[model samples]
Each structure stands twice: as structure tokens, then as C-alpha cells.
Target: MAGKRKTKASKAKQDDLAKPSKWRLQHGAFSGPIRAADPETGTPVQHRRAVDTLGMMLASGSITAQMHEAGEIFRGLFRAACFDSMSTSQLLRIPGSRVDTLSTMQIEARRRVAAALDLLGGHESPCGSCAWFVVGLEFSVREWSMRQGWAGRTVHGPVGQGILVGTLGTLAMHFGLTPRAKAA
Candidate 1:
């Protein structure tokens, strides 16, 4: 995005980052030695950006290792199944037997996605929000609840958060990422 691209000077402090700066940098949500190209000269620029949310959540103990693993798998499967399929011409409408063109791996990925949805109780399930909050960075639960008419109430914020946590927990269990209880 144009807004994300930082030029020579802007709100992001410009420094002679490496003539080079060897020190590791970590500020709030941002982390560095990111290798980016200067928009103007195409020179590699060492930069920092707000880093991984999943990692932050993991570090903060908001989610377990199992939850993180499940989230990673959920994200990886969807990414692997990206739009690599062939499309026929608009004028060429063949009446013959249609053939499935997706690769075995792609098909398997799609199956896994369906499995994930099934475990989450389908797209309409409140746990489906984990696919957004855990894997995707669309919005926070607070923002979601506000739009869903859970606004202004004292009970709603924690309720929404609990839903998200429960969602991640469900996924972890479904994927067998959770540890078993002690054998009696």
C-alpha cells in the first residue's frame, strides 16, 4: 500500500540505518532489521514495521503453543490453496464432461480448509472469528462486538474476548494440538 511505503522523510523517523546499524531494535509492536527497498532509488533499506500479532499473542500467554500451531496450519492451508487454477475462455462453453483441474496438493488443502470449517462448526459459528482474529488481522473483538450491537455494555467486551479465546481453544483441540489430561 502507498501509505505503508515510507519514503525519505515522513512520520516514521528517518535514520542513516546503515551506513549500518547493527543493533537489534524492538519498540512496542515494531521490530527490525527488515529488508525493504527504498521506493525512490531501489536501494535496500533496513526498516522496522509492526511485527507479528500471533507472535505477540503467543509471547503474552494469550494463546497456547497448541493454539498457535493450529492457527499456523489454518493460515498455511488457505495460502497454499490460492488461485492457481486455470479458467477457460468466456466464449468457449464446452458441453462435454467437465474435468477437475486442481492439483492433488491443492485438493488436499481445500479438504483441510473444509475440515477446519467443520471443526469450527461452519462459517456462521462464533468460533469462526478465530480465522479472522488469529490468522487474519481484519479487526479486534471490540470492533466486531460494536458492529454486532454489543456496544456500550460492560459485559460485552470480555464476552467477545472470551469467544475468541474459546475459538482458538476449540481449534487447538480439534487439530489435536492440546495436551491430554493425566491418566488416572
Candidate 2:
């Protein structure tokens, strides 16, 4: 052989690098065989079965389309409010202090988020408790569960996720995005 041969593990990794990723895990639930990636690095990984929370829930019939829309809207608002900007404020250029500023829309978005939080009640409220974590931070159910447990909270897997779903429903109602019920 003119050069070093490819080891079985290396060959296997190369083969596994391009697999499609549809499978997901939520609170230890499993699904796909998609291509994986190193969590810390962007390099290709192998044999990853993790999936996104909202997509998996929609596909698995765990959440309704309206709920999904609501969740997405909430996530969108959070993303927008964050991405819209908060550069330094010149209105108060008294010194070298960097005064953060936001546009009217971003302010409105933050207000809306505040209103949404109010609608969800407080940090102690069941639905409200997990809303920010799941919607804003986008934690997976398993991660949320672990975090809650670590925080000295009672963390039932299904119930925790249910609270998140319920919060999305509440958001949908707040946004007027909920679909009216069809008559039987």
C-alpha cells in the first residue's frame, strides 16, 4: 500500500456524516438517524437522532397546527426583539457610558413580550414558568426537565412539556392566531 489505509472507524464516520437528520429526542424520546455534528464545533458528527422540538411535536401529533404557529410566532417575536437592535444611545451622551437603545418596534416587541408574560401569569405560574425557557431560550424538553430538577422544582416530563404547550396556546390566544373550533 502506498499510503496508510483507512481504518474501519474512520470509514464508518465518513459514511455516517451525510445522513439526513429527522429523528429527535425530547425527554429521552427518540426518533431519527440523521447526520450529526460536534456540539462544540461545526465538524460533521455521526449517528445523531436528535430533532427540533416544535417540528417533532407537530409531526408526532403532540401539538396542533395552531399551537405550532403560536409557538413559532412567540419564537419569532423573541428573535426579532433580540435581533432588531440595541445599539448605544446618543440621546444621553453625557459621557463615555454606553447607553443601550432600541427602536420603537423593538420597544413594542418587548412590551408585547411583557404583556405575554403577564398573560401567562408569573414565574410561579405553571404555564408561565416554562414559557420563557422553552420559547425564548429554546431548550429541549430533556434539557428543561434536567434544569428544573436541578433548580429544586418538581419536574414531570410530560407535565413540563404540557405547560410549555399550554403557554403557546395562551400566546396564540393573545396574538389572535388561534383557530376557532369547528362544530361537530
Candidate 3:
């Protein structure tokens, strides 16, 4: 009886060992077991250099400056777009037009700047909502310009507002606006 009990206990222990670990059970279906990368092994030279460069840019506040510039460009576009009578040249000539245009520009600029900072800090991904808003705004501006004979006409009054808005929006995303994830 004692020998039988010992054999059963040993068998149970062996069976437990044969099963996959809890971590493996959770993450192994799609990929193999997760293992930490060895730091001593080191990443490839090119990858290491790229990482270093990005780190330096972040540390030196270059990315933040770039992001600010991008936002400023967008804000300029927004100011330029809101004018009901000013020609494109006139709008271009003026710097920091009165803060009386659509409130959307202000909100979007803030969002873009915040998103860029978040991306640089690795706190969040790029913002898709902001990108989409800009895209829609660009389309509307282009259509409005066309209707007003600003673009798609013999005398091109000014650079298309659509182009400016689209460019600014794209720059914002490139600097670090998080994109939305597709549903699985």
C-alpha cells in the first residue's frame, strides 16, 4: 500500500511537469513562449545607431521643436483658411492672423502638439482622430476653394488651403500621432 501511494505521488509530479507553464499557455498559441532578449548579445549595429539617434533627438528636444513647427504650420493654414475676403497672397503676408477663425484650429493644434509630445515620450501612439479631422478639413477647403474660383481656375489666387491643411496634418502624424488599430 505504501509503495503504491509513493508511485501515484511521483506520477502526479511527472504529469504536472509535462504540462506547459501558465505563461506559455496564455501566450504560446499564437507564438512560441516569450523570452527576454539578451542585452549582452546586443542589437545589430544599424538598429543600435537608429535607436541612439532617436534617443539623442528626444533628449535634445529636437523632436519637440519639430512638432511645434508642425503645429505652427497647421495653425497658419487654419488662419489662412478662415479668411472670407483676404486673398491667398494677403493671408500669406500676414503673420499670426487674429485668433478669431474657427475654434477647431486651436483645438486641433493643441491635440497635435500633445500627441507629438506623447509619442516622443513613448507614452502613447499617434492620434488618428486628429489626422482624420484634418483630412476632412482639407477636403472641405479644397472643395470650397474650387467653388470660389480660388483653385482649378486660370488665376490661381493662392496655394490651396486643402494642401496646407493636409500637409500640416500629415506632418503632425509623422512626428508621432498615434494611428487607430483595426478591429480584428
Give stretches of model 1 more than 4 Å off: 1-28, 34-49, 83-101, 132-139, 146-156, 180-184
Full-model lDDT, candidate 2: 0.70
Descending-lDDT candidate ranking: 2, 1, 3
Clashing pairs in 2: 20-34, 23-32, 24-51
For model 2, how does the per-residue alpha-carbon lDDT over 1-184 read when each residue is reduced to its tens digit? Answer: 5998876665433333354423422234545555768789989865645456887888989888877888888777777678434555476467765456567887777777777888899656666657667877688776776667534676878877887777877777777876445211
The segments of candidate 2 whose C-alpha lies over 4 angstroms from its true place after superposition are: 1-50, 83-99, 149-152, 179-184
Once fitted onto the true fold, the runs of candidate 3 whose alpha carbons sit more than 4 angstroms away are: 1-63, 83-128, 131-184
lDDT of 2 at 109: 74
lDDT, model 3: 0.40
lDDT of 3 by residue, 70-181 (tens): 5555445444444223433343445777534557765675565445434434222223223223332332333444444323452122444333333444565564452323
Name the candidate that leads on lDDT. Answer: 2
lDDT of 1 by residue, 1-184 (tens): 3667656654765677453333434223566468979999999878765455456777889877887777777777776665333556656557874554667888898788778777777765666654644464435566665654323443277677677667777767777777545110
TM-score of 3: 0.18
TM-score each candidate.
Answer: 0.57, 0.62, 0.18
What does the lDDT read for residue 34 in candidate 1? Answer: 80
